[model samples]
Target: MKTCRFILSSGLMLFAAAGFSQSDSTGLPGDDFSLQGALALFKRSSSVEEFEKLLNTESSNVNNLDLNNDGQTDYVKVIDKFEGGVHAFILQVPVAENENQDIAVIELEKNGNESAHLQIIGDEDIYGEEVIVEPDGDDAGTAMMMPSSGARYDHGPAAWLTRANTIVVNVWTWPVVRFVYSPSYVVWVSPWHWTRRPVWWRPWRPVSWNVWRPRRAVYARHYVVVKQRRVVGARQVYRPMRSTSAIVRTRYSASVGRYRATRTSTTIQGKNGRKVKVTKTKVRRRR
Candidate 1:
């Protein structure tokens, strides 16, 4: 019997917010790299090698990450790691001579010959949290209607809504995903590095947050944030190899600091268990 399950972790549960469209969104370093965009590109790619080229292609417009703060956009390399039925495609960038930063991971777990589940997780150091995005199921359309930024948003229907509701996304239907699960599949590790890259590739300067946000939204609308780790096997295999770049972390911290300085309000849980919106107030400190 083929079975798919998502194991939820215990913590402070947060309702799924519309993708990066909050009023208080001042943007972070993570904004430059879009997991939604990556997933969209991945779907179009036929193989891992082609996916790597698409990621670094100048005209693709899917990648805008400049993790090293260099004048040019970073070349994203793909590395596939697999164990049993789980495969983790680590999307990484060479930030320094001897250092590489993992931007996000495309995780897939095969439940049967024709059944698989997939999700992409953004690295916390870059994204400020464990952001998981997967394809929107047909039933996702039936989620409760709520107004968000002038558009209707749906929080999928479940008996009990928690931080993230489970949905079945059979990635086996995706060509590249199914190819990776085949017996003849070979693990793909990108050969192109900082000094050695494809002649067709040309890096461009990173754009301002304001300009990139809209481009990102185009891809973001196709995905949904799910907090639960459905592919447990893939998660376990990736944890040991998962890495964060110190350089990216430093830049992320600076971006966060700047964002906090201009933030107006924050949400907190009230005594009655409902969410309370608390406005920011400047309290003059006594001399």
Candidate 2:
């Protein structure tokens, strides 16, 4: 009887291990998302008012990001750069202040295959050490520390208990971004740079990952659109460029996980080639 019990216990253990492995490795049916598809999903499901409210918050124990650099923390927003289809998801965390503070931005490709990179810009003395957490057990990710009071990473893993499918890091591109320094206009004491180039970015911590229905199946799909601008009169523009004014038709976004754009209209496109009419969000920049 003891021998039989031992065999059964071992089998059960093996089964549990198998289950965990499968659960960890296996992603959702459409885990890999396209930019156009994701934008559709976000628009169809997300509440515009709720998103605006989130962006206007002055302070919150959770998701408090000072994007503009004005002593106070401003709200966060997602800027959808639509070229032909979609370009990238810009996680814009603005700070509150008179002069424009250095914005915190994380640019990501909708369907990056595999690559990894982390660059934290600001004062090495003021901000101090970085927190590098490889959460998700086997799945890979990296985050550097920034100077923030709420849910900020100082010198440890910015552990995001996120579903494996919502965000992904390509090991091949482990550290795609290079420098972390201040740009021409600097405000906050901490190090930060709003990179025009595309890089990986996770949302502010303590977000409602399961804000959507069907709790377990939800991801960070809530977002409104913002326009992205760059210095014109440049050379060899690959992707589409965003106009500060006017919305354009849907062309779909291309994934440049570890790579590299040029411009288009403001109108957004929905599923099955349905054009979703949206007003242009006038972004104000102060110096």
Candidate 3:
């Protein structure tokens, strides 16, 4: 039963690859690359040589580095033969991280031609395991895992990462029913561990009025300064009073009670032509 399942899986992979090859030959250029194409190519070519020759038309040197510091070097690069034309990709893979041994290298090339080549270089580990992914169920867009993971998103064809005895899973569903879109990529890394998670999905909802309500009205105080000169009363004129002398011996004495008083009053006007009254109360004599 296990052998039959393996053979069935292998046959399905080959069929998918052949379908992609045909599509590449005939599909319109400058269109968004599909996940289906990536999966098909990923399945058909397991080594760098096979990937490059199968998907690309030319080859160039690619530098290798351990981006994750996993001790084993893993690298993938693409070179464009024409100044601005199709690109050829190459990738190198090692059997294991700790071992000094080398594993498979594959090459993929893209030219105007539709047919791709797949070539294998060096000895391959036949026992090496490959990750298998497929639709979760008979549902048109649903994706499921053979070993289930807890996380799920609304729009999906799900993805999973298995490492260090733990499987991290991410499932997403498309919001639009008819159109195909790109999936968001997320990465998580730890010492000795690394994985990717798909973007979180949420339904579109109308914005809440409470969230955008205007804040309480604020009032600020301001003052203005005005300059104006005020005019008082006009100048007043004073008249002198005469005193009567009293009859006596030798030097005549002046009688203080015999004097007559004269009074003066003035009127003042404001800027608006309003009249204001002014009174002179008393008179004084200087000796």
Best model per TM-score: 1
Residue 157 Cα positional deviation in candidate 1, in Å, after optimal superposition? 22
Residue-level lDDT of model 1, residues 41-110, one tens digit each, is: 8888889988888888766667888888778899889999988878899999888877788889999886
What ordering of candidates by lDDT runs from best to worst? 1, 2, 3
TM-score of 2: 0.23
The TM-score ranking, best first, is 1, 2, 3
TM-score of each: 0.71, 0.23, 0.16
| Model 3 TM | 0.16
Clashes of each: 0, 42, 32
**Model 3 agreement with the true structure over 1-287: per-residue lDDT tens digits:** 99999999999999997665443321111011111222234344433334333332211111122323344323322221111221222122222343222222222221112222122221112111111122222332332332235543222344332233332222123221111111231111111111211222111222222221111000001111111100011001000111111111111111111121223468999568999776442442110
Pitting candidate 1 against candidate 2, the one with the higher TM-score is: 1
* Better by lDDT, candidate 3 or 1: 1
lDDT per residue as tens, model 2, 3-47: 999999999999997665444321211112112222222222233
lDDT per model vs. reference:
0.70, 0.27, 0.24
Query: By TM-score, how accurate is candidate 1?
Result: 0.71
